[model samples]
Target: MDEVSPEETPSQKVPPWLFRAILTGAVALGGLYVLGWLIAELKMLIVIVLVSFFLSFALEPAVNRMERLGIRRGVGTGIMFLALLAAVGLFLWAIGTVLADQIGDFADDAPGYINDIEDWLEDTFDIEVDAQGLLDEFQEGGAVANLATRLADNLINLGATVLQVLFQILTIALFTFYLVAEGPKLRRNICSLLPAERQRQVLSIWNLAIDKTGGYIYSRLILAVISFLVHWLVFWLVGAPFPVPMAMWVGLISQFVPVIGTYIAGALPVIIGLLDQPSTGLAMLIAIVVYQQVENYLLQPKVTAHTMEIHVTVAFGSVIVGSLLLGAVGAVLALPAAATIQAFLASYLERHEVVQELEDAEAAQHPEREPLGDRLRQMLDRVFTPK
Candidate 1:
């Protein structure tokens, strides 16, 4: 107001250091943006590489044992792969036979199953849901029909892109083969790049990962076998058709796939039950649920903990985190990755025992006015008990 002095605008008179800082930040941000774009572009390749690494780690133990018995690594890997392929081929044939024989029966009986469900709903919930109308709509262009159409379209699109998918698979297999063949040499070369102490640490982590991956496969196989036997017995007692194949399917799928695997395995038997007789379906459902409870509370924690050496909370959390980060692929790889990190940290971190204070222990043991820790302990005991 008082004859405003010749003033420089803020930008025109910016501090030299401030300007330099802004320029540096802009450059860093630009570099980060470029890096992010590159990663997004190559994400599929990244997934393939990770899958190959996981396979190599998982198969390393089998390859090593083969080597110990005087077989070459390359030949051993081939043998293991052939055995796996043959097993898979046999399973597929079993599934095909089951489907071919049973699908027509299921189709023929679907209406009866729907009528039973409709009657049950009316009796129990007093709700009027039109089973036939719904089925007609579903057949004639309802949401289900639309979904089926879209799925068919997607399958066609997938077929168009099959070559690329096959190429990616081939690339992964080749990389895994090479990795297993030269694992020791590769480890030595990598370790040579570090200090002796760091080298030991790296090798220790590598060995731990291999052991854990192999252990994980072994544990899953054991569980799968248990699942197969239990399911086979239940199906046979209930007079379900194709008991062997259905049980085998449940076992393999429930073990290999996470989260929804049990439900998926259970659904087939239930569907067959409904097709045959409504009561049978209900019984099968009850059995599946009961067995699942037993496995969750008794078998799973013991077996998985023994192999993984991780807490139940950690195992569950890792699966969720991995599912979030990498879709299905992440879920499959998360356990081994988490086990490796946990083992590595254990190597370096200090160990300590946590003893409860005497007073706290006394308070925890009190019948009434239970502490939160005591309540939690009780809950855990219930969740983990054999009963």
Candidate 2:
């Protein structure tokens, strides 16, 4: 019987479903590859759109306020852009003027400054440095000539880079203008495609994003103003040249730029002060350090408490992540983005007060002390809300 069955060997067949499954998976994989390629190609476009949307969100509240006062959205958006451009122009003018004058003075007094440096080096460190000789060598070795040549060679690249940057800026500005002007219509169109429940959710999220962005801007502006006033007074007192421009530089850079902003901001004043008087430089440095500590401990917590309410660690982490993803622009966007996400999660998620047991246990572990963050939050809440 075994031999008879063997003699009638059956042919094996592939299942129809198996073939279909293999075909479907191949198609899916092909589709995914094309999708990924498309995304890679459009990455810059995506980033630009995202940035435009962020700017739109930040400007929406002001636009709405203007609308309430009977201004057309388009007009309000245009006004906002003009104001922004004017502010930028003013900042550039201040920076250019200060830098040009300072540089001119430095160049004119270069030999004296070099002699002073040499004297200081000899006096302080018993080290001899022929700065003039070094300068002569640098020039004679054709280093300056090479530098000029390099600059000449790269001039075209620099020009191209500048053009690219300008184009990007204009693209962002155009998109932002449209977004702000047509925000309501955009929202309506988006909601029209969604169900009633989903519409409400989308609208709420949109409004929350706008609030967070606007609040972020407001808080930063207030902090910048305070920083400007404080630094301006110190600079004026120290007889730092171009005190207003320097203070404005410090305020805007320190507030707007993250992480190294303070150091960058302080550099200008420090240099200007040193050029004026050593004692003045030392005093400016001390004042800046003191003000920074005060801001970190007192001012920032109080101001951000009402507006952003984002934890310090979270903000720092967001900035780091953002910088990793998109360099400087990402770093600048990080705060508002983090604030929006944090606010959204806070609103969407359920929360409960800490139990007395947990609090008691924490107190027992750290006897007469509370966390700095918690203390600051509680203190600021009390101060601001003052029952």
Candidate 3:
């Protein structure tokens, strides 16, 4: 082969632009991968931030009202925080007390419940059950002792988890405090960087978000109160133990929690009822089902029509999608998020008035289409012919 100089080499013939393009592409892909890795690592932090932001939006209206009444934003936020903490503390206390008592009662009566269930099964399905013998075998096998040992061993892990949860709650509270107390400052700082028109647009969007979020909170609160009152009366009438806390449980969970919340809320009282008396459980179930129907048809529509302005199907879909993406947190945040997005889009989307009469007349006049060829010819003439 003939000798070739370095400049004449085939490799050297490659264009400079090709090398630069390859280098740039490699850098971009590497950066993207790094970004993805960081996001995965910081996923929990991202969820905390999102929750804080949602809470801030929900709290903004109250803070603003307090501000207008001449209270300092920080003070207002602190007051709100204290009130919220108090309410939560009360709720927890109620739940803890009732649950402790109820758990003890349930443990005591568990044998009776089992016996009843076995008898019912035997009577209804003609199946023989030797529950006492089975229980004796289970006791002899030391499964209960093993279970206790496992629970004791996991206590440390449970403590750590509780600490982790508290830390996350504190982090979210700090973020929410800053967001709400500095709401105006944050908006101003953001708007300062934009053009006048862009600033207006941003502010409008911010206001819209606040409205939707606050409206959602208020509407849910109203519904929760109504539900609490209704269920409290029913539970009281039915002689359920801890009616107040149980009603509160039903109210808050049914209103605030998404998807399976109602079932979880209703299941507790129904179980308690069933444990107490079958008739009580049946009544509880009937009341819950009837109330659900009334709320779906009457209360929910009237309350959410103005505030959420989102269709039921859309809300259901959003909840499903959110739950899939972020599990429980996403589901809780789905409604306000969907409402905000819907309102934002509605503002931007163009609309034209519908002419029902004209549409009906046109359809009546031309119920069937002409031949495809004739239609194509008309379209061609419309397009090709001069205006």
lDDT of 3 by residue, 33-143 (tens): 999999999989999999998999999899999999999999999999998899889889988888899889989989998999999999999988999999899989999
- How does candidate 1 score on lDDT? 0.85
Candidate 2: global Cα-lDDT?
0.90
Q: Write the per-residue lDDT of candidate 1 for residues 32-94, one digit (tens) a residue.
A: 999999999999988999999898988889999999999999899898778877988989999
**For model 2, how does the per-residue alpha-carbon lDDT over 1-387 read when each residue is reduced to its tens digit?**
355444533455556688899999999999999998998899788889989988998889999999999999999999999988998999999989999998999899998978998999999999999887898999999999999999998998999999999999999999999999999999999999999999999999999889998888889889999999999999898787888998889889998898889999898888888987999888889988988877888788889888887887998999999999878889989999999999889889999999999999998998887757568768779999957
Question: How does candidate 1 fare on TM-score?
Answer: 0.77
Candidate 2 has its poorest 10 consecutive residues by lDDT at 1-10
Candidate 2 backbone clash number = 0
Clashes of each: 0, 0, 0
Clashing pairs in 2: none
For model 3, name the residue pairs that clash: none
Instruction: Choose 2 or 3, whichever is better by lDDT.
Output: 2
> What's the CA RMSD for each of the models?
6.7, 4.7, 11.5
Better of 1 and 3 by TM-score: 3
Candidate lDDT scores, in order, read: 0.85, 0.90, 0.89
